[model samples]
Target chain A: MESQIPRSKSQLPIPDYQSSNSATLKVDRVTKRYGSGATEVTAVQEVSLTVAAGEIVLIRGPSGSGKTTLLSMLGALLKPTEGTIRLDGTTLSELAENRLPDIRLRQFGFIFQDFNLLSALTALENVALVAALAGAKGKEARKRAAGLMTDLGLKERLNFLPEKLSGGEKQRVAIARALVNDPAIILADEPTANLDSKIGHEIMRLLRRIAKEQNRSVVIVSHDQRIKDIADRVLWLEDGQFKEMVTMATDPVCGMAVEREKAAAQLELDGVTYYFCSRGCRAEFEAERRGQVVGDRLTLQVGRP
Target chain B: MILVAFRNLFQNKIRLVISVGGVALALLLILALDAVFSGVEQQVTAYIDYSGADVFVSQEGVRNMHMASSALSASVASKVKAVSGVASVTPILYVTNVVVADEERNLAYIIGLPPNAAMGGPWRVVAGERIPSDGEAIIDAGVAEKSGIGLGDEVKILGEEFTVAGLSDGTATLINSVAFISKRDFAKLRGDPGTVSYLLVKVEPGGSPERVAARIEAQVSEVTAQTRPAFAAQERRVIKDMSTDVIAIMNLTGFLIGMAVMALTVYTATLSRRAEYGVLKALGARNGHLYRTVLAQALISVALGFGLGLAFTLLLAAIVPQLGTNLSLLISGASLVKVSLVSLVIAAFSAILPIRQIAGLDPAMVFRGK
Candidate 1:
């Protein structure tokens, strides 16, 4: 049957940011509080950070350090008591709560720590749900979800429910769902907390590889220091403040430091855009091109090796 | 999707069964009362239709045939027969007394007609023979069935002994069980052998009952005449008024209580499944869609309950003679539809609050697990 899947722009994942190239996400002095008066408790206080496109940002904090709160604010899940958040170029703090859902759907893809797949649906069905919610047609959504699950090495388990899938398989299904809508950014809160160390590190490697290969910004809120080496920059959040970060990658296609928000140039190929930190790297990429058409079948299935 | 909603209901079989059972029991109560009311109405109307006399004359204020204490003098019969267009006159002597069958006495009615009266004889006899003399009586088949008495058996009524000579179809009082006897025996039992209770007057051929009834009323000072139907209707109206408040209250309470329970069950179920509702909201199910799903669930519940309740009530009516005569248990086709439609309205109304909650659910909640 002819599929009616939404034809996303080839430049999805690395959308052009007009002229505001310095930041893909910016948090300017954000604060969040619960309760009132005598019972008032500050969850996140005076926190600030920035992430450039194509860079993986690792947020490290203890349970009560308000890591989840910061992630929620960035994802438009919660409102800030004091400060503004900007995604790409739009101010998120000013958006109404009723309209927050639309912003989340259009710009953000989420991966919860618990791998929250609906219990009644299968792996393919779970991934298809996000596409369906984004207004994709039934047959097309299912087709795209099947392609995504097959790429995630879950082809054989596509029809299995959450209870039937193993822990790592469930997380993979959730990740496929997160990427299904082609959102500008993926916000994963403790995405590997429920898996074993081997599977956990495997998941982190997958996230870092996606960031570098596909030029999509990935933000993971976690306290799992074992996977810090995979992040391009690690921001230590203590008592609701960003303490430090380190840059670990220089874009091969550009002679500039890799940052989550400040990519220098973007190129569209096979309906997806690849970001570079400088124009020089983009030229080298063009010179080396074989001129062979980068067809729709660019994403290869990721089976465990 | 509605497919998901339907699957959710089947996911927990025990809860679904229990919920259906509760609805059925509630529906049964309402249906039982409706059937009884229906049965009593048919009995009354049937008796009136078969009585055949065109006009009825009795004491000026007397209402029902069962209230024989209001009997007028035997002279009223002759006065009514003398009216213009009157073709025949039959005195009806009706009296009630306690009669024993197996050491247990029940209130029994005695409808007394003349030995050879064509206007007021038992229309159908199911056993033995009709009352032949002053000391003989024809018992209602229902009365005989309940008392376990038979033809030729002697039953003592109000201190006088009479032989049960026959068994007739129908019962005492359109709403009560009764036996038939000769008019002379009825007077003897009531201790007034000369005074008769009601005068049944047949209009002459080709005469209108209304005109003759009017003429008789104007001529007789101690009695009034009415078309047979009007008199029977008056009798039923008088009896109904005496117990209207009680019956109305019982019916109202039953309906209200059933509605309250149904509403609570549907609302509580919706609240418990709020997260599931959020999933539906996120899937682009509009308010109208949500409303239809809830309405469908309610309609199904009420329909199942109504069917079960109606069947149970009919079975009861068939098995118990007292319920057949007194309680009515008519179960008419239109009445079945009416009661079920009433329940459907109740179910639909009860689902409103829950559907409103579903329609207003925040889609983000589906992601937040709230």
Candidate 2:
């Protein structure tokens, strides 16, 4: 029995601005499962999505919503049990396990929440390694990595190890490493989960700029709503299903979702009402506006909500 | 890739030192034991090599000078001298006895050579005369130093006192310290002046030792003859057989210890950096690349350890002789090559567990927040 279901982006209703011909990634009704019969668990189910070049797509969901599993499938790090994933028009599901790494090396870039830099290597070496693995000569790989780091404002931190760098600096180095190979699509799983809200927003803005200016497609899976504004489109997920397409604002100082009507603290900046999840986020935001130094202690109060 | 491996290894300075130190200690044990055995073998054969005799004539079934006793009639020396290729014949008598000097008893081999024999006597005389008369003896330098007996000192051999006339260098053998005395004194001590231990034969200038030995054996029906090199080899074989089991146990222990140390250090290093390896694999590095990185680390550690072990063995070789012990240390290029090959094999084997760990890593784990 063949049931009629929307299996691809073309069969669904997508906004005109996102329906571009240059689709860099196309995931069709992908389902991923683990274990056997009675213990069988589906991590992601019947998920279809498309990301075009020069687009920033954010997948937002709570914990256990299959956002990471879906990202893993899209990156080819995990295979889908019932669907196909295409990156740059190459069907990843049909490729053998040994052959998939080559596709990953040339076509995709991954950014993790922890900024998974090789602890033994310096920032430049960490970035240059990806380029070297992608078949660039040593000198050229180093040059490319250095250029990317400089572009990302991490030029002075090139020789710093990951443990020595600040959280913001480490994430920037990770971003440079992801861009070193000029990958067609960038996949970030909770890129700002460990950063201060200000720094997280800065990283999100950098990613957005990369998508808009360099015409590279970017996909980020995160529960942090602070970064939602920068995305061209947002998909909300729940319990291994795509719940809806929704728009929400996030506290710029705390990275929490803020319902405009119920926000405890709100301020008008540049004729826009910025909402905050708590008085603490609102105070930190105001301190920055007043040209005062906001310490980490002030940021810690962001959890008061 | 190699650079990454090197960086990872050196990242923990303490771990690097401990790993290298463990391997070095194991290598030191192996090399020291081997060198001591080699030194003992060399010391046992030194007398045969330095005898200056083209051929040696022993009793009919005697193969080694140290293990078996050989006695021939002193009259056979004239008959051996008359053989076609024999230039000279020196009859000698050997007796293992304890020498008492200053109330200290030391085991010594009393080698009685003919007083006027030009060959088969101490080649290096550090003091006094080379040959000892009827009531005098030439003591090896090692024994003289150990016993505190200098020239003119009276030492009792078999309860009969004899004056030390000279000191000989490098004449000590594995079984006992050598003391040179005249054949008359040895015959008087044994109560049979007509019998001698063996005969040392020197050949004509153009004669081959093997050919001369064959000629002597054909003419002397009651004795077996061998070239000087063959006799030295026979002596070495006896010493080797005597200590082979102990040496084998020591070598096997050292090898096992070295392998264990290498495996543990490499395993620890690999396990600690498992997350980093997962990141590399997530970045598209193949399993072969990670294996090479681990093997490269082991190779570097083993190479450094081998060099340190060699240096330590050389130091032991220089110091052991000065300590007044009979233990000799011989470090040769052949032994070094053998140890290095074993170390390399150990290093390669140590990489197996670490490689297996890396192979089992799930690259997706790098994405997990923890």
Of the true interface contacts, the fraction found in model 2 is 0.60
- The superposed Cα distance between candidate 1 and the true structure at residue B349, in angstroms, equals 8.9
Score residue B70 of candidate 1 by CA lDDT. Answer: 60
Candidate 1, residue A77: the lDDT equals: 70
Chain A vs. true chain A, TM-score per candidate? 0.73, 0.74
Top candidate on TM-score is: 2
State the local distance difference test value for candidate 1.
Answer: 0.69
Best by lDDT: 2
TM-scores of all candidate predictions against the true structure = 0.69, 0.84
lDDT of 2 at B250: 86
| Global lDDT scores for all candidate models | 0.69, 0.81
DockQ of each: 0.12, 0.50
Report the lDDT tens digits of candidate 2 across residue range B265-314. 99999999899898888878888889999999999889988888888989
Q: List fnat per candidate, in order.
A: 0.02, 0.60
Q: State candidate 2's DockQ.
A: 0.50
